[model samples]
Target: MARGLGATVRRFPAGDLAALEAMLTEAPPGVSKMICMDGVNSMTGNTPNLVAFAALAREHGALLYVDDAHGFGVIGERSATEASPYGHRGNSIVAHAGETYDGIVLVGGFSKAYSSLLAFLAVPTWLKDHLKVAAAPYLFSGPSPIASLATVLSGFDVNAARGDAIRADLHAKTAKVLATTTALRLATPNTSGLPIIELPLANPDDIDGVGHFLFDAGIYVTLAAYPLVPRSEVGFRVQITAANGDDEIDELCTTLRALAERFELQRHAELPAQGRRIGSATPDAEVRLSA
Candidate 1:
C-alpha cells in the first residue's frame, strides 16, 4: 500500500518500545507520523503493548494503525477491573484502546482465528466515510459473496461463545510441542498469546528437509527464509489450531522429536532466557541428510 501510495517507509529491526520511540523522534516534521504495527506480531507471536503504543503515538501527534489479524477472535477477554461485562470482545487491541483514542485505526482479517476470507477495518465514525471513498479495494472490488458473509458471522458467534476454551486448548498443544524436544528452541515469545511455534534451524537446507519430512509424516508446516524473515534466520513456522486433538498433537510432537534426534538439530547459541528472537542465525551445523 505504501509503495503505490508513494509514501517513504522507515523500518525498525523489531517492535521494541525503545526502537519505536527512536523511530518516532526521527520522523520528519510535517509528515504524518503514522505508526503501523501488528498487534500480535506474525513471526514473534508476542502481543504488543497497545495501551503504551497509543499513549506514545498520541504524544507524537500520530495515528496508530494496528493489524490484529492474529488476535481478532483468539485472544482477549473482559477485564476483571472493568465495570461493564458485556460488549467488549477483541480486548487485545481495538475494542479496548479505540475507546481511548480516536486516532487508532484497526484492521484485521477473518482468516486466522475466525476461519473466513474477508477482512475489515474499524475506525472512528468520522473517518469511516472518508476511508470508504479513499480506499481503492472498498470502492473497486466486487461485493463479497453472501455465503462467505454468513459463514464469518456464524463463525464469529462461535468464536465469541467459546474463544477462551479454544485458546486454552491451543496453548496446551503448544506446550506439548515445546516440551517434547529438548534440543529445539522456540523462536516465538514465551507466552500464551498465540499458538505459533517457530524452530530456528542452523542450515537453510534443513528447513526444506524438515518441511518435506513433516509432509511425508502426514503433518504440514511452513518453511520461511530470506525475505520472509532475515536471511540469517531460516526455519519453519508451526500454526497450532484448536481443531487438532490429542492424537494429532502427539503425532506432531513425535515427528518433531524424531527430526531433532535423527538429524542432531543444534540449539542456536544466542537464545535469550525466554528464547524470543533465538537470534538471527545461519544454521551451519552438519546434520544427517542422507535417506
Candidate 2:
C-alpha cells in the first residue's frame, strides 16, 4: 500500500526499536509517519514492548498501529491481584502491557481464542470515521455471518464469567510443554510461554519425518516448512488452549520427549525472560516506515 501510494518504505527486523528511533529522529521535519507492528508474534508467542512503542509514536507524532491477533482474548491488563501471568480481561496486549490507545490503533480477531470469524479495530474517532468511509473491506464486504456473531456474543459472556480461570488453565498447560522442552534440553523460540511454542529442528530436513511421526502419534502441530520459514526456523508449533484435556497435554508432552530422543533436537542455552521490541512512524509525502 505504501508503495502503491509512492511512499518510501524501509523494512526492519522484528524488535529493532533502536533502528526505528534513528529513522524517525533523522527524518526531515513535517513527515507524517505511521508506525505498525505486531503485539504478540504468532511464530514465537513473544510480545513486543507496546508501552515503549506507544510512547515513541506519541513522541514522534506518528500513528501507532498494532495487530494483536495472537494477543486478543489471551493476554490483557496486568495487576497485582491478577489470577495468573497471562493477566486479566483478555483485552489484548495493549492492555496487558498497561498502555493506552491514545495514539495507537489496535486490530485483533476472534478466530483464535474466541473461535469465531470476526475482527475488530480499536482506533480513535477520527480514524474510525475515516475507515468507515474509506476502507474498501468495510464498503465491499458483506456482514459477518450470524453464527459467527452469535459465537462472539456468547464467547464474551463466557469470557466475563470464567475467563481468568480459563486463562490460568491455559497457562498451566502451556507451562507443562515449556517445562518439558527445558528439561529435555530442547530449544524453542517461546520465551513468553503464551501457548504458541515453536520447537525448531536441529536438522531442517527432518521436518517431513517429524510431521509424520507426530501425526502417527495422534498429535497435530503446525509445520513450518523451508520455503515458508527460513531453514533455521523450520520446525513445528504447538498451541495449547483451555479446552484441551489434561490427558491430551500429557500425550503431547510424552510425544515431544520421544521425538526429542529419536531426533537430535536443537541445543541452546536457556534464553532470558524478556523479549525484543520496536515501533515507529512514516511521514506524509515521504512516509518512511518499517515492519
Candidate 3:
C-alpha cells in the first residue's frame, strides 16, 4: 500500500510517546504526516492515550489516524443516568477528545465490539471528497449486500436501546473474573475499566502451553507473541463481553486461578497503572493490581 501511494512507512516502538515526539521533530519540510495507531490496541489490549496523541499530533502540525476497532461499543461513552458495573466513569476516548481540531480521523471495525464484519470511518466534512478518491480500499472494494446492511441496522438499533445494560453486564463479568484471578494481568489500564484483560507468564515461551491448557479446559483466548508486544513477555488476552454468562465467567476464573498456582504466574513490569481496583467477590482470592 505504501509503495502504491508513493509513501514511506516508518515503524516505531509501541506506545513510545517520547520516541514519537523525536521523530515528529526530526521530519523535514512541510511533509504531511499521520500518526496511525489503534484506539484500544488489539495485541496487547492496551488503551492508547488518544487525547495525548491528538495533542502531540496537533503540536507537530500533523494528522492523527486512530483505528478504534476494540473501543467502539465497549470503552466509549456510557449512559448518564446509570453507571457501569466495573466503575467506568468517563466517555469514549474519541467522544471526550472533543472536535476542536478536525485534523483527527478515526476508523473502527465491527468484528470485536459490534459482532459484525467490515469497518467504518469518521472524518471531517473537508476530507470526505479527498478520502473517497485517495483511500484505495474504499474505491476498489465491493459494497456489502442489503442483508448485511439490514443486520448492521438491526445491531445498531439493538445497541441504542440496550447498550448501557450490556456494558454494565460486561463490566460485571470482568470484575467477577478479575476478583478471582491473580496470576495473569489485566492489560487495560485500571482507569479505563476496560473489559479486555491479559495474563503474562514469567517465560515468554509458556504462552502456547497456557493457551492450549485453557483450550482443553473449554475456554478460548489469544496467545500473542513478538511484534505484538515486546519479546520479553508472551501473553494471552481474554475479552469480556456482555453476552457471557455468570457461570462461564466463574468457571474461567476458577480455572485460571488454579493454573496460576500450578504455573506460579508472577508479576511483570509492563502492567498498566491502577485506579480504584475492584476486590474479589470470593474470599482468599484478593486480586491485586501490580502497579
Top TM-score model: 2
> Could you give candidate 3's per-residue lDDT for residues 24-84 as a string of tens digits?
9888879888888887666444556566778899999888888878877665542345556
lDDT of 1 by residue, 1-291 (tens): 886688878876545668889888988887877788887667656556677778888888888889989877655544554222211354455553333646888888888877778888888786789878887888998998898799998987875686556666666676677665433553343333346766666666666677778899988887886677665567777788889988999998888877776554446344333232111121111111111
Clashing pairs in 1: 202-283, 202-284, 203-283
The regions of model 2 sitting more than 4 angstroms off are 270-291
lDDT of each: 0.65, 0.82, 0.65
TM-score (all chains, Cα) for each model: 0.81, 0.91, 0.83
Cα lDDT of model 2 by residue, 150-264, tens digit: 9999999999999999998898898888778878877776667688988888889999999999999999999999999998778999989898899999999999989988887
Count of backbone collisions within predicted model 2: 10
Q: How much RMSD separates candidate 2 from the native structure?
A: 6.1
User: RMSD in Å for candidate 3, one decimal?
Assistant: 5.4
Better of 2 and 3 by lDDT: 2
Instruction: Tell me the spans in candidate 3 whose CA falls farther than 4 Å from its real position.
Output: 78-82, 85-92, 96-101, 183-191, 225-231, 268-273, 276-291
Kindly report which residue pairs in candidate 3 clash with one another.
76-92, 77-92
